[model samples]
Target: MMKALRAALLGMALAIGLPSGSQAQTLRVGMAAQDVGRLDPHFATSTIDRVAVGWMFNGLVRFPPGSIDPAAIEPDLAERWESGADGRTWTFFLRRGVQFHGGFGELTADDVVFSLRKSAAAATSAFSADFRAFESVEAVDPYTVRIVLRENVPSLLGILTNYSGGYIVSKRAVEQKGEGFARAPVGTGPFALQGVTPNQSAELVAHAGYFRGKPQIAGISYRFIPSDASRDLAFQNKELDLNYGRADQTWATRVRALPGVTVDVFEPAELAMLHLNITQAPFNDIRVRQAMAHAVNRAELSRWRGPDVSRPGQSLVPRGYLGFTAENGLPGHDVAKAKALLAEAGYPNGLTIKVIHTQLPEMLNMMQVVQQQLRRAGITLDLQVVEHATFHQQIRQDLSPLVYYSAARFPVADIYLSQFFHGRSIVKTPTAVTNFSHCNQADAQIDAARVSTDPAAQLKLWAEAQRTLVKEVCAVPLVETLLVFARRDTLDYGYKLVGSMGLGPQITEQSRLR
Candidate 1:
């Protein structure tokens, strides 16, 4: 069915004078990031870089929209899979005739094992946490692979959908190409790297022999324009076919009104929050956390940001997650309640706090708004905005008492829960990404959810854990972000907010550009 759909789309594109062959025209895309460092899927973290690497790689399993059953894992290189009755062991059946781009030979189970093990190997990878649950990965035969888990992990398959975690790389290509392979990766996807201009832009050409089928348009290029306004200008000048991150709704409205341009909104499974350091003096008390939560005006902030663009966040788990509910949610604004809590926490006269943040123009605006809101509740906030790089370092070092941060992921409850609250994560470093009120008992509960096999049981446990964290005033939820994509009307595309931004290549056949 997919092949037939691809053929029909290709025929349609050809009829409209768009390129149908490998040397077809390049579809230019613009983004807010400056560069994509490595095209290697295993090492890449940023969404901008991941989208580029995604084109040049294939995973054993592909996630199609709206499907969660492991048995229904869509095929890329693997044709099918089966699990033992105990659910600890999983076997994958590889496709017989697929070959990697750039003249690598057929992919086999050994390559699968090598790729995963390399990701787990500390010397070779930065994504070790992604595969920490797997006890062993082995090749059962030339075309079959088996994975043994330390325990039953029902979310293992769902976790594999992450670009950093699940993408499969060719062992032959890596061994033959060595370190340079990251820049010039070879995969079985529709697009292959044509050229890269460091931090500026990258070009990709469709691989005619792509296993699924070739993309309708011939090639695609990503132009890095870090400034949102600059990206909008590029789109207006016909230099870009699509723009990924547009925060200004006013500019989005203007762009949509222009000729040959259209705007699409994607409701992301992402969270934007104000992370408070619970280990710090002022925030150590639960009353202090509750006071801050009640002091802020979420509804006003959401309105100021834009409608249908930002909804007041209720929990660390966004609204779309399986276990999110009002009962397990954060406390809303109540100035009197906030003042009372503040007094009880020994700050009756109110105390001043410092908010360390990056100096992005939009971010500064947000911080100013939050600062003013806190002042209205008789709480004084000192703003300490700095450069992006410096701010990130401070957060990672836990030197910052409060900071604004955002995370995008597939709508998996575990992704948010495990990454933020899991006890063993380096991201949960003392002053860093710790999601708990202070990373205490909450960490154990989150870990249990990750390794649990039963879905219903996991949901119940996670829900209870979330309720505890919210009641204890761990992290202050701000809003659930809605991603906006703007493009020239001549370009036709369908985007679903899966993870961050851009379309996943598994569904690229649905994309059309004239």
Candidate 2:
């Protein structure tokens, strides 16, 4: 029956002369993204980049397949690991017989050391800070690795399990490919990179010698389709086996009603936030930042996409994060109080601040709502729109007084606080790439938590950091969006997908078309 349904859909698609699906065993995935920013595992910044890298790489530790649980930690390349009683030293036992792509011999302790050390390099890697606690990484033996930290390093496994810097790459391949490796990455995973056609698509073929097992599907073709409507059309015509769905509930509900279509909505998610640059004039005044924080109506913002599509954000940490709380530290909407604060800040005549955001539709809608709401509080939001990459570039250069960022990261509190609040991360400075707000209030608390051996104490420290940001009004949290995806009912993900950190769903050796 599933095969018949797929055949019918294919017939309709070809009738219209659209491109057809791939071979029966080759699953096609359509992403609503412009391009895969970078394929290098160490520098994959965007969701699409992570998606491609995940297919062909393995991390020392990983979140269990299809499990979105923030605390889910499992062995990936490292079969098992142990840490010293003091929690400063960790040793991992690498799984033997794992072969790198292109038959680059077997994975060993040297590849693990080279991959991790490179990821921690401040001069080159995009995620250098995550590995800041690492004092050293050494190959103890051919299949053994040891990591020693300068401090206790709370939740050390969590750091190694994160998607960004955790992927272990092939040392031999990197030495051979050099700069060209970005286009042709080699890893020891269930699949191997066949090739990529620039901004269009990436083709991956299954590895017969994959350590876990051979992939059920023969191959996968990832298509980069940026337009929502185009993705919908392609999915309907069976040109794509799956699609990254829209954020608004209307689209999700409509898609679910279609025969042989199933829609998945789950969390934890990326927090959509507005970052105010405190270094700037008006924002430098606490009263002005407080006024801006109070001016936001989270309920009103989530209404644009329906409550089902987005959760009204409460804190710096989202629901799935370890330190999440109901009272997230920001004041509720109070226009009268906001106006009073504006007056107190000597902006009674009203202040106009420029905010730059990406071209995504849901973002524009939310910003429009923000524009009207801030007007009621005597704050004019001068909105500027730019493409996604350009928006990230502009915000980092300190160009926009108010910057909008929506990201779903590892469920770690210190990671969030450090990236956005740590002074060392102030973009355009010597070291960091984020931290649009030049915030330094939580440095002490964040540092204290980093070395704490007690879990409860560490959590308390993280929560304290959130409280400081709330009081300082560094950034205003608005909404949390769940990852929503639609697929042909005939396709089987093989694993139970509760949530994911990769671009869409986890397509592993088990996923296949029914």
Candidate 3:
């Protein structure tokens, strides 16, 4: 059965960048899911898609390759960039030798301009909102691109990094291939897409023409197995070099005990937050919101959430991020105070709210703990579970009064505040976007910080907005969980795995089998 499955997996892509029947110097990987969303970086929402494209794309700037700190931005496609004295105009000096795959032609200012415009179009990009500050972007010369902003923005570099809206695509490739560009993507990264076989698997080969030079491994085969047990079995059988790991402590410990396995744990993982539809009735009342805020005991919650993998971060903004200044005043376990607030809000009998969430193990475990906590405060929670994709879809349509979500974004406070709390992004409104709470409380301060050229002033404004979000309970920040992964000890990842910006640990050109 295993042999038949292997044959089916590589049936078509066996000749990729290798003579037919060659071993391919292959590195096989097991993912936590069956497939990725859109392979287009601009619209890719799931981590599977993000990691897939990260191998084929190059952003103008990157987060200092291998470093987990979001603020550590460095040049990628551009050799260096300079800002005008007024701080409104920025010019990027492109690296001359970069080339797109499949002879799409040398990357130039034209491609950069095209990519920026593409990302800014609301019709094309999920990240169009990030480009709101752009006044103009033009190819000044063959290797020079200029960007003019309406105002000086502090998070400009953050937005231009791979984690944000910085990926640059081949204009020629996109124009010629049209919709097909996403399936067989073309970029200037260290690897090129060899083949894709839907939910089963995908193959990528090292790009010898890669400006960064040839990768250590000749090829990679990514196998999609939504079943965690199947993935674990494959890893034990040596069919995969790496496997996506469960966040549960028991699973992590079991993996760590394997003789030839290596386990990596990193911090500042996805923030688990509960968003209340503030546009709705009871939540519309600040007293009721406060009651809900005081209902959670983060310490007890962590035990249910796998203590070794979770920590109570006191701000909507996670720790290790800029403007992380509020750890003192966040609401905590106080059932008596919560009950008093509910009484004052004319709900002495307490209230019931329905929450819609993904059916993943972590989400289920966390919500169950939350259910018990809120019940103590006389708040009844009725949970509706759905598939991961449908949960995101339902919440965006405002179908639930409460929503629990886990997400990671560029560590900039302004971007978080703007996208998640700004009036312009309130869900169900005409401008409905990611603002699930339909909140406008932080709009003024968030906008003020966005345009501030002075870093200190910008940080202060961003900090103020976060404190406000916590106090108002628009979305109660819960815990920042740890990310874990297990890989064969024989494979050596050249760079230190301090942390990762994507769903899984990175497999770069430097990664190789010993």
Return whichever of 1 and 3 wins on lDDT: 3
Candidate 2 per-residue C-alpha lDDT over 403-506 given as tens digits, one digit per residue, 9 for 90 to 100? 87777777777777778879878877877857888898989989998788788998888888888888899999988887888999878988888877775687
- Going through the candidates in the order shown, the clash numbers are 2, 0, 0
lDDT per residue (tens digit) for residues 224-295 in model 3: 887788899999898898887777778888889988999887744777788888879879998998998899
lDDT of 1 by residue, 1-514 (tens): 4244345444544553456554344577886666666677766644566768766777777655323334555766778888899788888898987777767877888888988898776446646655677899999899999999888764566545535657777889889889988788877776777667766778776666677666666667777776877887788888787777555567567777989776766645347677676778788887888888998888887888777567777887888776565677678889999999988989889989877777655566767887888887778888787755466556656666776776665456666766565555434453233343345557667777777777887888788878877776667877666666777765654444333322322225445576
Question: Each candidate's root-mean-square deviation in Å?
Answer: 5.9, 5.0, 3.0
**lDDT (Cα atoms) of all candidates against the true structure:** 0.69, 0.80, 0.78
Alpha-carbon runs more than 4 Å astray in model 2? 1-24
TM-score of predicted structure 3: 0.90
Choose the strongest candidate by lDDT: 2
For candidate 1, the per-residue lDDT at 327 reads 72
lDDT of 3 at 208: 62
Best of the two (1, 2) by lDDT: 2
- Of candidate 3, the 10-residue stretch with the lowest lDDT total is 15-24
Task: Return the candidate ranking by lDDT, descending.
Answer: 2, 3, 1
